[model samples]
Target: MRKLAVIVALTATVFLASSCRAETVCPAIAQASVVALTVAPEYVSSVKSIHLKACQDGRCMGADLDLVPGSTPIDQGCEPGSYGGDGVCSATSSPDGTLTGMLMLESLTASLIEVTVTGTGAAGQPLPVRALAFTPRVAYPYGEQCGSFITAGVVLDANGLRQAA
Candidate 1:
């Protein structure tokens, strides 16, 4: 009886210790925001193409943007399509020129990920702008009882540049 008890206690201790050190994999969240803007040429009119420079961390295998109401994730190789409607803006200028629009991001799970704009500049002049950081909540599976968390923000020049950012 005594030997059996000792064996059980040892097994329990080892089990508890191992379980405490077990690795837990949590979903990763990467996000960025627009802090400031700088317009050059002074007289540059009609919005063309907007460029947002962003930095990201973690394994973002793929990414997609929710530009239109029912727009789906298209191939990264193709040029980013237009938002609003078909006949909205006809000029080919900087899209980020205006700072009023929706920017949606989708990525795989990560432990800790964040994105931010490093800097903004024209052809040769660097502009002064602030960095925006955001932490997105995990999106739960559908019909699984848990509610899904959606992170929505303005699509800045940084996001339009890279995949992670």
Candidate 2:
């Protein structure tokens, strides 16, 4: 009886430790607020394409998000489509040449990285931008529950945090 209890406790301890560690590992999160690509004098455009990558934890995922001229629902792509329907993020461009994009970010484990802009500038010229200024939405004090649900914003009761500059 004593031997059996020892083995059970050891197994439980290992499992719990592993689970907690997995829950704590955070990925990178960086969002692009303004995007401007000026390849040359003739190539000067306000909007092009947006790309975001979640990098870290031996994982890397990116998508060619859509760019619009105004604010819209980020969940618009919850449906199904290819060109004009499905996308990861929605960007709003200002007349002064500011691009503000939003991604709800289901899981906020530090993942919003690698912003790339690729598209044609004015006069139908190729303009690819791999570097731009990005601002990471200030991460809040977060905790997960059962490793699937979070004890934070949605289900968890905690005062939400504000964005960092």
Candidate 3:
């Protein structure tokens, strides 16, 4: 009975520790899509994205959105695309298309992600992006196939977290 009690206690302790580990703990590396959306030509003026990766200790490598590519041909008149078919939806983080910038992961939770942008353009201004919070996460409902490159089907703030305006 003594041995059984000890085993049960040990198991309980392990279980508790595991449960505690489930709490939010920053990872060694992570990625977030900080996109400004609803852009014309590519996206339906409703999709955007952002990206970042942990590079070194206390430092990270950031990425800017490739917005210039948005000049690509786009069909303004959208239609219901096949969910499984290889539709025209596309996205790019090149330094020219869409509104994107460097991504800095400050912290993250199951429902919330804190990040900042340091590249690309926000409202035509070469402004540095502040660490924005993805409360409940930013998701776009109006998604098209061909616009992924420009729309990227991603997001940051619902109001388009751009710099100038």
Candidate 4:
């Protein structure tokens, strides 16, 4: 009888140990440090090219941004006279007359960043230089377990260079 009790206790412990285990599953994705820039339509029309200089943690990197036409997705709010209220949902791509570029950085270990932006006018004249000093924001977009990434955004508009919200 004592042997049978010992066997049952061992089985119960094994079952409980197996049931108590939890698995952690994470998404498969990659992330990098990048600075994204945007030029307002009003400003984009006047500039032919953009040159960017960025410094962080005593390291400096420079690049001429390959600005591309920017677009936004618009939700028209469903289709008319369709099955269910979901019919009113529709999306359209609209060009906002903006130009955008992304600049990859080695790292954003420092809190402070110094940036210089120079533009060439459509007529081949040099536009005024804009400089800004600001702190970048860090995020764990895929959750903390997936690691962290840093990003900075600047917009050039009629008001000149400014941090993006």
Candidate 5:
């Protein structure tokens, strides 16, 4: 009787443990189409390359834009990185060409701005982009805190350029 009770208890514990296991679902990552990046007149001359990325719930998607070592800035650039990887920009558009979401970028010292392109082809297709501007805001001194650092409101895309429904 004692052995049977122990076995039953172990079985129940195993069943409960298995049932209590939590499931983690990763969010879907989509590629972003960069249409244009315009820097302020003051930054236009000093700007080199602008790294862009899309984010949902604080996850950065696409390639990191490094705008330091280059000659002649590019007006239009492709999505920085590949999908499901760090330093990449994800798409905020639905299956169709409509943009109901936005791609975000991490704040750096440089000023930048992203614009969404829409319509059809080179003249009309919809393209949404998040622009980051290099401004004299609060700077994090070298090494300070031990948490995620986020600088919001650096890029203004208030026109619903990249909003996904």
Candidate 6:
């Protein structure tokens, strides 16, 4: 009985020591307040130029965003030389004519923000202005220990602007 107790105690000690040395390793990734914008597919080809203006806590920023072909991720293994791959799988973009852009901000503190989206068509004809007053969401995407980040999204469609779900 004494030998069994000593063995158990030694096992417990080794287990505790090993666990103490275990750590949560995180990647060295930079964080930012990025607002992703997606133009509806039906209007993607029509919108040749996009201008975005966002305001929060009395500070406002405006700039023209360069729209690019949008893609969604696939669970299949990544192909060679694919951008933003997880080393296991890559994103796939179909030629569906969907264009997307990003509106980066120095920081977004206020819960509520005002946004204005304006653009021109392929012929320089102005598209209808889309505006929205919505709140951004805060998330700890990497984990709570990694800290929180504020993210916002907007959609521009024939119906106008609306916050992303």
TM-score of each: 0.27, 0.32, 0.26, 0.72, 0.23, 0.72
lDDT of each: 0.37, 0.38, 0.40, 0.84, 0.36, 0.83
Best by lDDT: 4
lDDT winner between 2 and 3, please give it: 3
Q: What tens-digit string does per-residue lDDT give for candidate 5 at 16-94? A: 9999987644334332323123233333333333444433333345543432221233334345456644554344422
The global Cα lDDT (0 to 1) of model 4 is: 0.84
State which candidate, 1 or 2, has the greater lDDT: 2
**For candidate 2, lDDT tens digit of each residue in 80-119?**
5578876465444335322333333334344334333344
Off by over 4 Å in 1: 1-50, 53-112, 118-125, 138-147, 152-165
lDDT of 6 at 49: 95
Q: TM-score-based ranking, best first?
A: 6, 4, 2, 1, 3, 5
Pick by lDDT: 1 or 5, better one: 1
RMSD of 3: 13.6
lDDT of 6 by residue, 15-82 (tens): 99998885776667876777788987887877889999999888888889989887665555655555
Using lDDT as the measure, what is the rank order of every candidate, best first? 4, 6, 3, 2, 1, 5
Q: For all candidates, what are the clash counts?
A: 15, 8, 29, 6, 38, 0
> How does candidate 3 score on lDDT?
0.40
Give me candidate 3's TM-score against the actual structure: 0.26
lDDT for position 5 in model 5:
100
For residue 55, model 1's alpha carbon misses the true position, in angstroms, by 4.8
Cα lDDT of model 1 by residue, 1-165, tens digit: 999999999999999998899564544543443212232223123223333333335422212222222122333343444663333323333343333322233442333334433232435444333344454445564433434544423233432321211
lDDT of 1 at 75: 33
